[model samples]
Target: MFAGVDIGGTTTQVLLCTADLAVIDSTEVSTPAREGGQAMVRAALDALSVLRARVPSRLLGIGIGAAGVVDSRAGRILVASDSFRSWAGFEVTATVEKALGVPAFLDNDVNAFLRGEAAKGAVVDEPYVLGMTLGTGVGGALRLNGELLDGPHGAAGEVGHIPGFGDLPCTCGGRGHLETLASGRSIRARYGERTGRLLTARGVAEAAADGDPDALAVYEAAGAGVARAILITAGLLDITTVVVGGGVSRAWDLIQPPMLAELTAGPPVSGHPIRVVRARLGSGAVAIGAASRARTELDAVTRV
Candidate 1:
């Protein structure tokens, strides 16, 4: 058996899986975001302890999928969002391994999400993919030739931080980033700016469904921004297949039309129409992917 953990800003999810990555048991707990990394890890560990007690199989290893710029090679979180106090520069895998007496591996949450989709979800067997998640913030990862590229700086596929979308400020303190227009938080903020009514992204989607013109326009702009980001990625990486997931993507009915229209307006130079699809694994992608990572690494070690 292997364990997979996804440590997010608001929640921490843990899963017990078989060697092939089939989930046997799972649980979730609130992440102590402001309490520091030790508290957050304790939350995940506590849930993991509950899951471990229900299974009789010997645990082989553990894998963690965490939000931030992770240094997977070092088994540490190199940089994290401000929401997580004392998260950056923490030795995640070492701490988990010491507490649980097992080998542990760590990866960027978005990288794990992409790996999960490639292994068994939306982009299964696809050779090339660009995975994006549109939640409170936006994240991206690249999978090429069946392998994920972390790049020299571990920030290779950070598409959301790319500039030139508009003059809107980004959470990263940059001006005119894709996240300013395409993230769930951005969608809500954009709608509020137009209507003076603060609503959740879901509420804005409901308003759009009810024929609210302002809400409709806000979604359209978001869709257009996403389309532009996809085009730029397609142009540079020549990767046309994309998988998008997260909270905002639930409004696919509202976002897809404008996104498709924008894509059609400016096709990539290679003349291949970008194929964008929604993620199939839903919220469990990261955990499953982390399990898969552990399984792969353990198998490789055995062979070596």
Candidate 2:
């Protein structure tokens, strides 16, 4: 058996699976992100303890998909959001391995998302695809020739931080980033600014479904931002397939029209016709991908 952990801003998930990738069980726990990386690791270990009690299987190793610019080779979080105070520079892999007395591997959550989709979910059998998640923040991953694109800076697929967007400030202390417009947080923020009412992104979607013009405009703007990002990705990489998921994408009905309209109007490039679709794995992609990563690491170590 192998274990996988997905550490998000609000919660962390633990999954147990067989060697062949069949999931046996899973658990969720609140992420102690504010207390720092060590606290967060303890929360994950607690979740793992619960899962172990349920399954009682011997785990081969553990893999983690975390929200940050992760240096997978060194198992370090190179950069992280303020939600996780003092998270950067933490040696996640070594810490987890030492705590559990088993090998541990770490990767950016978006990379794990793409790995799951490319290996078994949406875009399966397709070696080259773009993966985007529109949640609290916008995230992206690239799969080229059947491998996740982990750039030298461990930030290669971070399309959400790309500049040349509007002047809205981003959480990363940047201006004109795609995250300012395309993320679920941005959608809610834009709606609240226009209507003077604070609501969840889902509430904004419900209002859009009810044909509220202001809500519709917010979603349309989000769609347009996503379209712009997609076009930019296509222009640079010539990748035609984009698989989108996350909380915001649940409002596909409200976003697709404007997104398609913008895509239709964009200038023709090498990958002129882009195909944007939803992810098939739903909430389990990151865990499955993390498990796959653990298996890969185990195989590599065995070979060496």
Q: Could you say which candidate leads in lDDT?
A: 1
lDDT of 1 by residue, 190-300 (tens): 999998999999999999999999999999998898888888888888886999998899999998999999999999889988899999988999999998999999899
lDDT for each residue of candidate 2 in 1-304, tens digit (9 for 90 to 100): 9998899999898999998778899989999889999999999999899899999989899989999999999999999988889899999999999999999999999898887787678888877688999999999999887788999989988989999888999999999999998888998899999999998999999999999999999999999988899888888887868999888999999878999999998853873588888898888888888988999889988999
Question: How much lDDT does candidate 2 score?
Answer: 0.90
User: Which residue pairs in model 1 clash with each other?
Assistant: none
Error of 2 at 13 (Å): 0.6
**C-alpha lDDT values of all predictions:** 0.91, 0.90
Q: Which stretch of 10 consecutive residues in model 1 shows the poorest summed lDDT?
A: 149-158
C-alpha TM-score for every candidate: 0.98, 0.97
